[model samples]
Target: MNFELDEELINYKEKVRAFALKEFTEEVARTHDIEEKYPNELRMKALHEGIIDFMNPWKTMIGIEEMCRVDPGLGISATVPYFGAEVLMLHGSDYLRENYLAKVISGEKMMGLGVTEPGGGSDVAGLKTVATKNGNEYVVNGSKMFITNGTIADFFVTLVRTSKPDDPAKRHRGLSVMVVERAFEGFSSNKLTGKLGVRATNTGELIFTNMKVPEKNLIGDEGKGFYYIMEFFNISRIFVAAQSIGIAQGVLDRTTDFLKKLEASGEYVGEERKFKLAEIATRVEASRLLMYKAASFLFNYKPNPTITSMAKGYASETASFAAETAMEITGQTGISTDLERFFRDSKIMEIWEGTSEVEKIVISRMILKGEKNE
Candidate 1:
């Protein structure tokens, strides 16, 4: 019932905000967006400065919100170097942990999660990527698309099918998770360009042709990657909500500043503009509450997937709404300012993690099933 941050978290929030303001400068964000480049240098800077403390989920969540509020591209780029760490932390073998997780945590290596196949889209269970076990190794073939950190990640926690299900209805049954190294032969990536938003984040296509992954690289049990990834998505969607909330708040900040400046210079401030700002602020507050409620359930280990879906779906919608309203309120300046970039950045929040449509399905199914635990 309590919505207030404790002293420690309050201090941490300020620290993260300060770090984002200082490092993710407007010029740096603008340059990265223009070039469609990854912010590897900024990532390294944040890592070295201890801004990315994975041991504390609260810090990570607050850090994401604060950083994204400053600039979505740089903020997401800075925080997602170890994007698949939770999978490793929960299910990886000791060898995988010592070799892969350690290196990534130390900032010596970058990693990503690969679940979306080229043709799969959001049909996670329908993915065609296959990994046939060959005695001591698994030979993987197929390709992944729209993968974050695809071109630069040293390795990927990839999901692939190991066998066909005995029951025709259970297409999700034979999936498995594994650590696939970039150094392995027959693995290649092609960078994707000209994204509409969050251009500072690295994205590319991953192709696997007879790529060899050691048998020991398998995470948890075979034929459980579907469940593992679903679990990961449930947790990750909270961060996506945080990102959405941040973008919404960022829109609020910029619009307020713009309106204030207009008023200061003797421009008329209309009730319509005030109403739009009020609506955005209310949604931002609601999104924060929903995000916190979802995160509370999830981080505490008693997750309600329904609440998570609601939070992500609503927050992402709010982000897009806020951005659009910001444009209308800012008028001509929106055409030539960071508001355009913010508008672009707001869109991907709904697409990545889970589309707003996907989230609606999750929410609807759960609600209709009499599972209104939220």
Candidate 2:
């Protein structure tokens, strides 16, 4: 497959680079890092610039990679608002699209995806959140942890169980997804602090205590939430890979600069340094290719499950490894606040979207299925 980006995509990348460099300045980045505050102004700017509406999953992934290459936190701030809105844009009702998409694109309303709960992280089917039907409203009672953009989201695309235990033997069939507005009487959110990284994204917890969600808020159909969630993950996993690749690229750029400066001063002796640089570059390129392949699959609307899993797993692992190499190359300077932040941030990429272990399991399952079919 051709790995080179077309002229149009290259032009798009250049535009993204220019915008990110201008809008996400080092000073602004530091402020967000120090205060653990979300970059709302920057997010609004991105929305106005149409960066938030590049609905093609691949293009959005590329845009995110470019912005995050400069600053992960800034990138997160720019794209976090799109997480829930994208689901609605792709699969939501007409009323949902008209009511939410425009406001989300304009930054007037923010949204979040609530899938992970305090009870389980990777075991999504084990979620304890429940939404029981009333006359015309669904009464939701549950709490979600580690939700991105939760503190500021005007609404959430929440997963809940709507079926009884004896309804079916299928583990994921009883679940349903709903849109819960923050204005509901029993809806609340609390900001979570002291995070390992991505401090600017405003991680938080969402609580729905008998929140009355209108029947219209239900997405698709009851007992199909797992499928929708999986579908969302198919797209989201690619973006997560993009984010990881971006961080890896950032670390590579910084390390290359440092190596050039050090080599110029004759501080490093021999081709060992050169060899290490070349190796790191090779790894970075491979990771980028995997990410692009995953994006391409998404663009074609083909479910390349193995490729997606490989992209997410490999990109994340490569990022973590690259960060470690960067630290080794930069020595004590790598431990500085900036590099350390990247180091810390790279870890979450492997764990979120799906853990590295989960990715492995997904890949293994695909391989086993293929073999059985043969």
The candidate maximizing TM-score is 1
Give the Å shift of residue 141 in candidate 1.
0.6
Top model by lDDT, which number?
1
Give the poorly placed runs of model 2, Cα more than 4 Å off. 165-169, 371-374
| Colliding residue pairs in candidate 1 | none
| lDDT against the true structure, each candidate | 0.92, 0.84
Measured on C-alpha atoms, candidate 1 has an lDDT of 0.92
- Kindly list the per-residue Cα lDDT of model 1 for residues 317-368, writing each as its tens digit: 9999999999999999886888899999999988999899999999999989
RMSD of 1: 0.8
lDDT of 2 by residue, 202-315 (tens): 888999898899999888788888988988888888889889888888888888888788879988635775677677788878988877777776677676877888899999
